[model samples]
Target: MGFMDRLFAREERASVEDPRVPISSPNIIAFLGLDALSASGETVTIDSALGVPAIWAAVNFLPGTLAGLPLHLYKRTSAGRERVTGGLATILHDAVNPGMSSFDWRMYMFGQVFTEGRGVSFIERNAGGKPLNIWPLDPCGVTVKRFEGRKLYEYKDGSSRKVTYEASEVIDIPFMLKRDMLGHRSPILTNKDVIGLAQAVTKYGSKFFQNGGVPPFAIEGPFQSAGALQRSAEDLAAAVQKAAKENRLALSLPAGHTIKQLGADPEKSQLVELQRFIIEQIARIYSLPPTFLQDLTHGTFSNTEQQDLHFVKHTMRRWIQQFEQEVNLKLFGRVNNRQYVEMNVDGLLRGDFKARMEGYAKGIQNAILKPNEARRRENLPDDPEGDKLLIQGATAPLGSQPARGIGDNGGPPLNDNEGNDDAA
Candidate 1:
C-alpha cells in the first residue's frame, strides 16, 4: 500500500479498537454550613459542618481501609468591649482586637466529628407549630448574627438626642463543597445510620442557632425559620435509605448468603452478568448511556503501543484525581492492555464519532423525509423521477407518528396516497 493508504489503514485500525465506549459511573456531591454570633452578657458562639464524601471514598475504599485521621472544622467569634491596655476609654477604644475568644478556643479544642458520606436529618418545631423548610439553607445561602448586652444610641439633629437600640444584625455567607454523596448507599454510610445522623445533626445545629449569639440591630426570631436546612436533611435521609435498599436488592442473589458469595461463584457469573445487562437495558430505555468505567489493569502491563493512547490515559487520570479529592475514593486495578485500549477507542467512537455521525445522519434524514412546505407553496416541482426513486429507496419505514403541526390532528396529515391524489 502507498504511504497515504498505510496511514488511513492505521487510523481505521485505531477507530475500530477505541476503548472508551459507553461511559458509566456515578458523580460526587457535597454540603456545608457555618454560623457565628455574639449576644447579651458577652456571649459568643460559632458552629460549622462540612461533608467530604468524595475524599472519604478515595482514602477509605481505594486503599482498602479507612484512614484514621481528623478533619478540621474551624470557627471564630468576637469578645465584648472592655478596658484597653493603652490609656483609652473602654467605650471609645475597642479592648479586644476581635481575636478568638476563650469560649471559641475551647470549642475548637475538642474537634467535631467531620465524618465522610454521612448526613443528619431532623424535624424542627417552630414556636407556632408550623412546618418549615430548612434544606436550602444547609447547602446554600445562610447567615449568622450576634447581639451584645450593650445598647447603641441613634442621635437625631441637635439637643443630644439618644435612642437606645440593642447591638445585633445578620451576616450571610456561602460555602461550596467538592462533592455531595447525600443519597448514595455505601457500606460506610447505611440508610438508617444516615437518617439518624441527619436527624441528630439538625437537632443539635438548631440548638446552636437558637441559643447562639445575636447580631447588632437584629431581633431574635425563631431559629428554624428558614426551613431549607431541615427539609434538605430529611430529603437526604430518605434518599439515602431508598438508595441503600435498592442497592441491597440489586446485589442480592437467590442462593447466595452474601453479595461477595454471589460474586465469588463461577456458576453464578451469568446471573451477575444478567444483572448488569438489565441495568444497561434500563439505561438505554431512558436514553442515557452507561457511565465510564476504567480498567486500571492496562497501564500496569508491559505494552508500548497501548500507552500511546495519550488522550484516554489523560482522561482517566483526571477522573481518578477528581474522585480522590471529591469522594475520598481511590481506584486500584491493574490495566489490561487489550481491554483498556479497546474500551478507550470504543468510548471515543461511541461518544465523539457516533454523536457526529448521528448528527449528520439526522440532517440527511430530515432533508430527505421532510416535505418542503416552502417549495410546495411556491408551486415548485418535486424531484426528477430518478431522484424521486432514489429518495424513496433511501427512506426508512415510518415506524412512528410524525410530530403535530399547526391545525393538524394527531395523525399523519398527508400520506403517499393523499399526495398522489393531490398531484393528480
Candidate 2:
C-alpha cells in the first residue's frame, strides 16, 4: 500500500547507480558483455541517454514501482494458508546494508533490468548452505560464458578480484530474448534509433538555449581595411553582449553599420514542438504514457487514469513478474514448491475509495469478508459482533457451517428460528 502511494505520486523519481562502462570498440563489444548487443548494438548504454529527463523518468519509474511494492516470503501450510513470518524475511527485506532499507535493494535490482536487460545477483550462502546476503553484480562488468555444457558467470568480487560462479549460484533475469542462450536484449540497444533521435533533439535544444536562443549572426562588410572591419565586428559583438546582459534597450553602433536579426526564433521554428515530439517518442520507446514523462498535452481525466493503469498492467507488470519469478527461482530453488516469494500487487490494481468501499461492502454481503475483517482493513474499530460472518438471515464462523439459527449458545431450546434468522 505504501508503494501504491509512491507509484501514483507525480514527483517521485529513481536514479540508478552503476559503474562507467568501457568504451565500445572492436575488441570490447557489448554493454553487458553479451552477444545480444550484436543483434541490435547498444548505442545508448545506461550512461548515454540516462541524463535526458525523459529517460530518467522512464527508467526510474519502473524500479520505483517495484521497490515500493511489498515482497513477502511465505511457507505454504497444510491448511491452505501462507506463513509470512520466517527467517527468510531478513534476507528479503533487511539483508542490504545497515542504513539501506529493503526498498533500496529491490530498486537497484529492478533498475538493472531496464539498463542492461538482465538483473544479475550473487547469492552468498553460509556454512549450512542457506542464503546469507544477496549481492548485486554489475552487468557491464559481468561476462557469461559456457564451458562444456555448463554455464560460467564471470564478475569481479568485492575485492576487485576476478571471480567465477556456476549458473546455480547466480540469479540471472533476462529481458526479451530469442535463441542466444548466453545473451539478453535491452530496449536501449534494440530501439537505438528512437532513443538516438531523442538524444539529438535534447542536444539541439541545449545548444539552442546555450547561445541565448539566438543563432550566430552574420556581419555585412565591404570595408576599407580587413582588420578594421574585424575590429568593428568584434566591438559590435561586445557592445551587443554588454547591452543584452545589462538590460539596455539600445546599443551604440558605429555609423556605416546596420544590424539584421539572424536566425528565426525557436518558437517560430516550432523547436518546442520538436522537443515535445521527441519526448513523446522517448515515452513510446519505453512503453510509458507521455503523461508519465510530464507531457500532459493529450492527457484527459478519464483516459489519464486508464493510461496509468495500463502503464502498470502492460509495462510495469512485465518487469514485476520477471522480478518475482527470478526471485522465486533463486530463493526457493524450485518454481512449484511450498516455500516461495510473492509480491503484493493488489495495491497498484486497487480502485478509488468509493469503488473500494463498495467492493468491500459486496464482499461482506457475500460473506467473503466479515464485518470485523473489513473494518480492520479500513482501519476502523471492531463492533461487538463484527466477527460474525452473516449470510442470508444466518451467521457462522468463517469456513464453518451455518448453525441454521439454532441456539448453540448451550442454553435451553427457546427463541430460535427454523429458517435462517438471528434470535435473542
Candidate 3:
C-alpha cells in the first residue's frame, strides 16, 4: 500500500480498536487477574459509563441536590418540623466520622445505590443500642441468600474473607424490578445494547474533539526527489499534529500541493441528532426531560421553565420520594407516630423573583403565611403589622357564618351582633 493508504488504514484501525471498548469484545482480551463488572464485558462499566456527559450530568445532579436540600423530620400532619435529637438524624446531618460529612456520605451512598439499583449499609449501634453510625456496604460485596431467609447477606470482606450478616444486621434499600428481594437487576445488566450504543456515541464525540474535530485532509504533490518528498511528508505531518493540538481552525500547506478534504460533513452525518438521540435514551432511564440532561435543541424561554418544573415534579420527585421512604423504613421501621424525613422541594418548583414574590404575597394575603414569615424568607426586617395574618377583604374564614340566637333551629344563641337585625 502507498503511504497515504497506510496512514488512513492506521487511523481506521485506531478508531475501531479503541481501548475504551470492554474486554469481552473480540477486539480486546481480558486480563487474567482482572476483576470487573459483568456489564463492563459488554460496554463501559457504570463507573466508566458515568463519564458519558448525559449520565454524569443526571447522576451528579441528583446526589448533589439531595445532599444540599434541607431535609427535615416532620410528623404526618407536617405542621411543625420536629427536632430529631439522636439516632439517624444526627448521623444524617453529621455522618459517622470526620472523613465524610452527611452531604458527602449521603451523596456517595445514594449515587452508588441509585446507579447500581441498590445500596447496602450497616447501621452500627452504640452501648445504648441506638444507631451510632451508618456505614455503606459495597453492593458488589454483598450477595443475597435466596433460600436461606435468616442469613441474608453473604458479604465479601475487603481481603476476600466471607462475612455473613442477618437481615436485621444491614439496611438493604433496593430499586426492585419484580419479585427479587435482592436488588441485583440493574440497567447496566438489562439494557446492555442501549448503554453500549450510548458509550460508543459518547466515545465518538470525545474522539472527535480529541482528534481536533478537523476533517481529514490530503496532499497531492508534483514530482520531487524521494528524499525531498519524504522530508515534505514529515513536515506536513508535524504541522497537522501541531494544528490539531492547538485547535487552530485555519491551516496553511506547502507550495505545489493540492489539498482535498475527506469524510462527510458533521451535519451530513447527523452528528448532533445522533448525540441527542443517545442523550434522550439516557434521560428515559432516569425519568428526566431531555432538557435535564442538557439536550435543549428545541428549548424555548416558555418551554424551558415548564421543563424545569417538569424535572422537579417528575424526575426529582421520584428520587426524593425513594430516599424519604427508604430512610423512614430503615431508620424508624414500623412504628406509631414515626417522624419521617422530607426534602423541601417547594423551593425547586418556585419560579423566578417576580413569580416567587407574587406567590408569597398571595400566601400572605390569603392568611396562609404571615407577612413576617414572608419578610423573614425575603431577608427583610420585620414590620409590626407583618406579624398579623392579613386576609383579603372579599374572603372569609370557613365556618365563620353569622351566629344564631339561642334555641334558633334548636341550636345555640346567635347573638354575636345584638344591635344589627338578625336575618335567616
Scored by TM-score, the top model is: 2
lDDT (10s digit) by residue, model 3, range 200-280: 666666766665775566668884788877787677767767888887767676677876777766778898788888788
- The better candidate by TM-score, 1 or 2, is 2
Better of 1 and 2 by lDDT: 2
Go through the candidates in order and give each one's C-alpha lDDT: 0.26, 0.70, 0.66
| CA RMSD per model (angstroms) | 34.1, 11.6, 13.0
Prediction 2 TM-score vs. true: 0.76
Count of clashes, each model: 73, 0, 6
How many clashes would you count in candidate 1?
73
C-alpha-based local distance difference test score of model 1: 0.26
lDDT of 1 at 175: 15
lDDT (C-alpha) at residue 341 in model 1: 10
Worst 10 residues of 3 by lDDT: 22-31
Clash list (residue pairs), candidate 2: none
Local accuracy of candidate 1 as per-residue lDDT tens digits, 314-406: 533343333223211101124311111100123232344465456545644555422333233235665433122112344456866454543
